[model samples]
Target: MNGTEPEWLLWAREIQATAQSGLAFTRDPYDRERYEALTALAARMMARCGGADETALLDAFRAEAGYATPKVDVRGAVFDAENRILMVRELVDGGRWTLPGGWADVNQTASECAVREVREETGFVVRASKLALVHDRARQNHRPAGPHSIYKLFFLCELLGGEAAGSLETAEARFFGRHELPADLSTGRTLPHQLERLFAHRADPSLPTEFD
Candidate 1:
């Protein structure tokens, strides 16, 4: 984990999520008020830990104005007939290879995000088929945080055809078999188990999609 998020900030994030959960379960107005106060305290702590203005942090917290939840992260595992996995290296991750993926946008479903990310990162047009796996990243024991709160949705994608190329976000692209996983995998963004699930899906179409 980077020193960018101090222990205090991490504590505040947990407290904030807990406070939101409390609001969901509490029925009494007094209990709701207490939860709100905890949320404000969490915001203040986050502000202090992140070196942001307290007022701004509080305002941002208030912007939600209701039960809050974490964001969703989605990824795609595009495979060829040979069962080789398509991977891309992103500049943000020091050009380390990963299966293409990104955060779920406001209008895009998990499948859409998967396909979108694949195309954007690898310049490959692919259709997201069955949802292969849904992983709780926090439970996955991967990195602390890659870019945002991500619930990884790895989908089985079929190539629709596009020239393999790199963008500003991606610097390299290639295909790999199970034994050829690059040493420079972006573990912070992609985990081995997550990829393993995709490989299993590719190996067996009967495997059910596991969700959180």
Candidate 2:
């Protein structure tokens, strides 16, 4: 366990994961009831600690029926001729900037997901050149926003020609240099150090993929 995480958050996450796994595999009616109760309790605990709506949190938790696993988040690191990286201001995050990417879709490969996300969010067609990083979001100092763990995949991509345009999910799409990055970053999606590492990979293509 990372010592940096809050004790309450760690406890709540573990309880929620255990309950979810138990509910998924257990066939006994009595055991199912217990697991359900455990899940409810975990939800309540998180709501009280995190100041979220308990009922909504429980409903979200209950929506996932399978054995619990880390969710995959795909991100693209697309650089222009001047080495500036592409970024999008997310409407969901109140216009905070982040890398162009999102949750991996079921029928797509990781690279496909990255390329699609870039096109969807930033209106840029990209070809994934290489996987730059495979980072566990929890261990990467990203601000906690949800109960589920996330595995973030950052891909180095080549711009394949498209005008800068924003979709419903994004308000703006542009490129920025390291020193000129916006201060209002979507930390939950992209931390400063993570971006720094991406820029490093962009500069030196021979760098091996980073993993946590």
* Highest TM-score model number: 2
Tens-digit per-residue lDDT, 132-194, candidate 2: 999988888788557778899999999989989989899989999989988999999999998
For model 1, state the Cα shift of residue 159 in Å.
0.7
lDDT of 2: 0.92
**Which stretches of model 1 miss by more than 4 angstroms?**
1-11, 18-40, 43-66, 146-149
Residues 131-153, model 1: lDDT tens digits: 98887765566654421244777
Each candidate's number of clashing pairs is 0, 0
Tell how far residue 84 is off in model 1, in angstroms.
0.8
